[model samples]
Target chain A: MSVPTIKFYVREGLLPPGELTSPNQASYGETHVQRLRLIRALLDVGGLSVAGIRGVIEAIDDPRRPLHTVLGEAADQVVPRYERGDGSGIAEARKRVAELIEARGWRTYEGSPAAESLATALAALEEVGHGRFAEILDAYADAAERVARVDLEYVAHQVAREELVESVVVGTVIGDAVFAALRRLAHVDASDRVFGETP
Target chain B: MSVPTIKFYVREGLLPPGELTSPNQASYGETHVQRLRLIRALLDVGGLSVAGIRGVIEAIDDPRRPLHTVLGEAADQVVPRYERGDGSGIAEARKRVAELIEARGWRTYEGSPAAESLATALAALEEVGHGRFAEILDAYADAAERVARVDLEYVAHQVAREELVESVVVGTVIGDAVFAALRRLAHVDASDRVFGETP
Candidate 1:
């Protein structure tokens, strides 16, 4: 980004500019520059507004707290509470899903969406069969929730507040990207597993 | 999303409407409808465009693939290869980060931004001497990568083809949203941890 853009960020309290050397020329150290660039990427590439970016930047700059604390806060911003099935055949589905969550050892709330999605899937599955969909999907949802917790813990270990936020945003998107890429790689692995130059 | 929007999607080949029941009427099954809604959320709310969204949807629709493939590709896209500092003080920082990633047992390519970010952070630590910024972040990255792998495995277990694509889209955005929300909850937990509850 341009120095003027950096200057604007400084003026907006989005960044802290380093000491000025002269009337017009000012020196920027690495953190200042790095923070500036990161903020720009989060704001521009990531499409966050200044205020949202500011909140993230401030969290990153703050040192008194542990990084996980900030990451947990960021995670909360994104996860929605899933509730399942209205009075429509969804009620039975919801119960089965709740059972699945319970079986997985997750504490499902009154109106969690994972539970709800499960319920919806259940209702839909009823059309297919009682035995097939219920047990398997519940297991998957439980696993998904567990994985999410692990993802958070991983965030705690790896990133400061700013990077944590960036990672969650980028990771979630890139996770899908990587998932697709790896799936292709897996095929290559499979093909190699089968016929092509097996080691 | 509105029916017209669904029509627009059908026309765009992003979603295919279900069987036509009469001359002017068509019936969309729950799955088709749900898929369309998920697509709308990703494209509109998540800010993914037609082509970007299409890549994701196509990735999901490919049941023969796993999510790790897609996520790996996405990571490569967003976190591009970055040049390490050339004889600059920043280079020292980069070297340290590379070492740290290696120490953490992560596979660090020489020119990746993730590697560079770690390097830059290490350089900062050299000057700052490890308070808020330190070597622990490398550990966190390692953990984050593991968590991502786990998430991909979970997705792999449950979905493929159109469902895979839909799950990827919803799961990707929702994972971010869920964590962000959880992060908020953690803040509340932090607040409770720090400041006692009101009488």
Candidate 2:
């Protein structure tokens, strides 16, 4: 990173200021290097907005925030947000998501943004005339559970608290893009099986 | 759905011009109405750029593009794009993706952007020190296949080719958001299982 870039991250509170060695000189340590890497991952690989990156950094720096909930705050902004007008099937969609959570017996927090994000997506599917897509939600949940297990296992292996939170945050956000891209490739494979070649 | 939005879509070449009954008294039929819905869904739900929606419309309008290829075109831009510097592990990632495709016997096109997109993601994972995350590719591929099959089945049931194409395009983009949101919620559940309540 350059001088200006490091200064910028410092201004944004994304990184800690280096040790002031003189009126014009400063020194950074290993923590600075690791934070720089995390910031780069969030921006370049995760495609997080400035605000989203800030949210993740805040969660990390806040002592009051629980370790388990840190990634959730970072993730809320990292996931694309959405809304709908009245009569847009949003109410019913929310209800359905609520039922899925209840039926699954998952102990998540109240009003977690992930639930709303799922609801908004379901409503959007309905508005697009593909409400039937929701039928496959169970299958998707089953798959996602398997993935989250893999992810949590990776996260659990981290010895440091900061390392564990950062691990899950990166896994949750960038891992989304990874899974989505893989999904598209798999679509090509599945399409070939179902529809065959253009010829 | 409003007049100005409809005109905007027409101006952007996303919707066909209404038949000019008079200088300012053009009449639109069922096709226009359907096209309008698709435009809204792409904008509000899919979070696609104007350029992406235009790409989809062009694929729909062009005569030479095959049915199997249309969604692929729209999907390339819809899926997030990424890149990396030299010695960033990208070359190795690309080779791995190619091997995966060949191993799976998927007959997708040469240099398909989706393949490149997947490579970029895997490379990013490595750059972030989560290269082992790629180990779960088979699990993700399995889950994605199930979702894609369900998507194709719903698309196949549509009576008209136009409707079928629109169904798949809408499903592909919006479905990405839906699945990502679901994955996060599932993570919360998995976290509870692995770590219990944070005390």
Candidate 3:
């Protein structure tokens, strides 16, 4: 939290400007501190770019926006866009993603960014000759469902609409990191058990 | 994917140089192509750095490295290292991570990179006044265990030790991306269900 970084966020409109108490000085409130903390959390831990953070903060501050719309935008902004490719692997992967969604009875939107992200990963797996990895889609979806349920439960507990929206944005991004780390730990444990290796 | 990128990878030792077929001409084989794809997948899709890809390639090329050891190294390499902090939030988050691991009966190493990563996320959440988000740890870990079982089972079916190691590396990295995407989709569905919003 350097002065320059704080100034940068304020300049970028990711954080609100402090109130001017004098010609040469501004008085920062607790809200500014909290906002700065959230900004840092999103940037450092969530691995979001400045532009991505701006989008999230804009969604957070815009009361006219619907909560679901805000969440969708935040999630979409965080995921990298996949370029349209004519590769068969990508086409097949897209089909696989749709089938997985259908098989799992997930009610995601058509052309969901998550679906595209999954498709990109599947295509990459196929490109690397791990096409068979798609076989684990069901398992991955099952786990995803369970985690998502927990996330929604937490967000639903928020009484304030603004808090709920912010929770969804933060939870979606930081929760991904948390779950990924947990998955890695679980992988280590499972691999050790399967191979008879001591931890 | 480009000539320059391939040359860069070769220079970085992340990809091996092509064999010289003549005084001024070099030819690459299937191994080179596959290696190049793996490097690209790791860099472009897996979000690993050149140095991180180098570590993964080295692990893959080393026959003497045990599968679990190689997987650990690869997973460790992908996660950003957390700087030592004296903040109580970080210290508290670390304790929570340890508690979550113990409660879940996971056999992760004492200073496991996953644990550190989780602690870092937890700390960030707390920094943003979302310490209560740690409540979802048990649920996340449960889902993570289920996903890890499927991953290990898939790796176990690999006939060759090299394939097994590579699968773990790929599975740990790209699997995170895949699962994150799936989780986002699941989040959309769950949020819709909870808030009564149409997808």
On TM-score, the candidate that comes out on top is 3
Task: Name the runs in model 2 displaced over 4 angstroms.
Answer: A1-3, B1-5, B28-30
Note the residue pairs that clash in candidate 3. none
Q: Score the docking of each candidate (DockQ).
A: 0.10, 0.63, 0.75
- Runs with alpha carbons beyond 4 Å of true place in candidate 1: A3-38, A41-47, A54-199, B17-27, B40-50, B63-134, B138-153, B156-173, B191-199
- DockQ of model 1, rounded to 2 decimals: 0.10
RMSD of 2: 2.5
lDDT of 2 by residue, B61-161 (tens): 77676677777876886865764565678789989888878876666654678887778778877766778877777777777777777777777888776
Write candidate 2's Cα lDDT for A1-199 as tens digits.
Answer: 6889989989988888999999888999988887887788788767788778888988977767777787687678776676566577778888899999998877776457888878888887776677888777887888787788788887888888877777888888888877877778777766666666644
Candidate No. with top DockQ: 3
DockQ of 2: 0.63
Tens digits of per-residue lDDT, candidate 1, A1-199, equal: 5667877899887888778899877787877766755564444333456766666556656766455444433332223223322544766656765565455444335344334433444454343222343323433343344335444454455344555554543333223222222222232233233323335
Our model 1 lands, by Cα RMSD against the true structure, at 8.7
lDDT of 3 by residue, B48-156 (tens): 8889988988998999887788888889888874753546487778888888778778888757888998898889888777778978778988898899999988888
